[model samples]
Target: MSLTQRSSGLVQRKTATVQSVGADGGVEERDDEGYTPDEEEDHDSKETRLTLMEEILLLGLKDREGYTSFWNDCISSGLRGCILIELALRGRLELEKAGMRRRSLLNRKVLLKSSNPTGDVLLDETLKHIKETEPPETVQSWIEYLSGETWNPHKQKYQLRNVRERLAKNLVEKGLCTSEKQNFLLFDMATRPLTDGGIKQKLFEKVQESVLSRWTNNPQKMDKRMLSLIYLAHASDVLENAFAPLSYDDYEVAMKRVQELLGLEFDAESLKEGANELMWAVIAAFSK
Candidate 1:
């Protein structure tokens, strides 16, 4: 039989019921509906939902000291499930299932929001980019490992083995990678040879100069312009403090170091203006 049919048969078998009656007069055989009369009666009597009072009582049960066995019993009896579903429907619950267990909800708030289709599209594109642009060496190695000879009854006769098989399998099974994988990728990228402290310094300088041009071109409100200057000045102060303490006489030397890292070609007046701009921008960004 096909997998679908097999799955359906398993479901039917699992959900199936049989009934029998003892001499004392209990149910013996299930009716045509697959459930014994008693089973149906029990199902009908089962509480599938929670009442408002029960919800209030459950909330009360959660104390600073922690819940008791009685409260746990009530939760295990299925009241919590109904209450959780109700909260979810009411946009008051943030559902995060971690391996079938729930996390704490300390200082939590629930707000209703629609899923962002744009974000989903962007995320898919980003993932594709990562896959495409990942070091060619890594991809080639993974492919070679996959196509290597291996045994498999269900898949190709010639199978390679490597981490991608497990990774792809996990992606298909779990839907997506966890946050840990993202962090790992970031660390890996950071360790690549192309990026260094000097590169970061140059990039920051480029971004800062670009922003300065925008600040100069756009005539913003007085308050906005001042705020922007203050922010940049604060950032400069932070950078200065982080560097080795230098004498007031060494200010020129420190400024030269900054220019070197930024890859700036300095004339006389322009060099002075850029230094002032960098210092103010840093101070504005970092200082309170």
Candidate 2:
């Protein structure tokens, strides 16, 4: 085949490859887009590592727990900070592996999805305000649900609604989640999984281009904290159920939520999830 034909053939082949895989663990015609079990497993592994890193950072954040409470709190704390830290650490480690100087790395902060320059301070303030402003049950229920302390076979109705309302309210006050249409779209998006296009080569190329451009930017402008947040956005974008092409507004809100949730400002372009098949191939690595 000519080089052009070869390239074309490769793209076609990849597209077909993605199309063959289905959500049910059986090879069938692609109708609904989703991940297979293998992909899901890989995603979990990656997320597990990321979660570990997040826990480490959160531990660092509070200067708490020498050893035992670390693991327990990681499990209990919504696996929250770990995801952002994991992405930042990964970026840092990647830069180091590429021979970037240690000092340069130290000066740069990894921006995770939910980072605040003064994370502990923000949490302290948010908590204090919560204590003063909201009803005690509202705060307690949010804490309980987030800690995995609440369980209902039918989905803890009161806890879910109450926590959502309280957090939404708190976030609104903090200018984190406003009552705008954009915020509402983002809130809806957060609950849904990404699944726009199946893992085809064409989609992969677009995503990969987007990822590389975002990731390899000037570190001076885009710090590690923001990079981590971008990374979570990228990962969130790749989930089969979550992968709709986001409008700039959607992207902005998503990024903001990640920062609010993870406590960091992030670049929207960096840290994207790649093609459907590649995503599937790496699912075990990304999921917690």
Candidate 3:
């Protein structure tokens, strides 16, 4: 395929060897991303690394334990949020037309801008649902539907089953995680634990630096992928772990900044001439 087709993202995406970190904190030549060449200047693809869903899942998983908290109910919907944002970032989806100034972000419908495959099964699965829907569902509605939290039996078919496990398998394929079986007293189940400490460390540091040293007071100026990471992390109820290792003062400061982001007027941001309305819509849905 030509470079143009490759850069179009999602549809024409195919994984290629790329960069990651080594044990020595030096540039480790590795592999990732079927979406775009890292050197390419495309704005959307430029900020992508492990896809928003993968990064958030990585953050939530315990390195030694190899699973997330059983009591936490938020990550389910949070992963759905990640899927929506991931689709938007890949240029395969967008919020419907904003004809009226009075429409709330939550009420805005999500629609397919393209029907092509995103080279990733989960994304393509969700895309297929969106494409086959009648009038299209609102962002808030889509989140519930995808999470299997909806009451409508027909819409229940829209749910993506075993999302966390499926994403874990993707991580296993990437070599960042190792699949193993663990007993939980009731029964033995398969788990994917971090096999590479370096990769998770680098991801942790990136999340740390986003709010610590490299913080752009303006979300628009921040790397869109990282910005999405912060919000998704929060929605997943795992943002605390990212800040847990910080100094007391730094923790307080980081959380204060996070609150600022949480309180943002998503509608105002969505109304911008070229804003990512789908992203803002997902954020708005999670905020409630």
Candidate 4:
């Protein structure tokens, strides 16, 4: 399928449910269960505005704090993985076909045959890096390398850079977030707080419904974008944010479902034939 075809279908499904708020501060529900009218409207308005990377970055970000949680250490690499998947979905990248050289799965390279610009600066820069690197690395290695997961002999630890700040600035440019500078005793710190609460709430609901309801019952029928979101969120270690509001029983069930999904293995033939090959590839990259 064409990129437009694949993306348009998912975008439509995300925003199809229209909603309205009733008096007494109660939200009216439309055809879709578990979504209020305002939430549905929010989803409709912003679902297609942000790229997958932006959405993942938004999820990792802390509201009003202007930065992602320090505890979610894997988010930088996870966001890079999101960029790769988004580029693959857009037909700008593809996995190099297996050859007779007996290479390790983790060493498999990503081929950048298309120079098509995604128009997003971060994504374009990443694409250029992939294209220009010599003796290209596998998806897993690329994720680590791009996230600056490099060994520091001086500190004797792995070091990462400020990917969150860069992406946050991009979000600010898109008007999804506003930047503010605050003094921290000795220095001024910049922060990007979300300006749209409705979209974030809708994104949370989508993940919640997928885990507690959709994936738990019908994994095969789940939307690829939703699947991508679940895997990326978990890989980034920020999935708990999505599950924080659930009841005890619901949380237990959601965790169990996530485990089951993670345990699944896609057959080689199936992976080659499906539109979600990039999704499966991402799962493999994180699983390793």
- Number of the top-ranking candidate, with TM-score as the measure: 3
TM-score to true structure, per model: 0.15, 0.23, 0.84, 0.74
lDDT of 4 by residue, 133-226 (tens): 7777677767766766646343212223465777788778766689898777998989999896666776777777777655546445666566
Q: What is the descending TM-score order?
A: 3, 4, 2, 1
Best by lDDT: 3
**Residue 262 shift from truth in candidate 3, angstroms:** 0.6
Ranking 1 against 3 by TM-score, winner: 3
Predicted candidate 1 versus true structure: per-residue lDDT over 1-288, tens digit per residue: 000000000001123346667566965665432233432211212222122112222222212222222322222212212222222222222322212332222112222222222112222222233234323222112222234322444323213223222322322232221212213444631111111122223323322332332224322221222222222222222223212233454444434433332332211212232122222222221221
Consecutive 10-residue window with the lowest summed lDDT within model 4: 1-10
**Which runs in model 3 stand beyond 4 Å of their true positions?**
1-48
Q: How many backbone clashes can be found in candidate 1?
A: 32
Candidate 2 Cα lDDT to native: 0.27
Evaluated at residue 275, the lDDT of candidate 3 is 66
> What alpha-carbon RMSD in Å does predicted model 4 have with respect to the real structure?
11.3
Residue 53 of model 3 has an lDDT of: 78
User: Which 10 consecutive positions of candidate 3 have the poorest summed lDDT?
Assistant: 1-10
TM-score of 3: 0.84
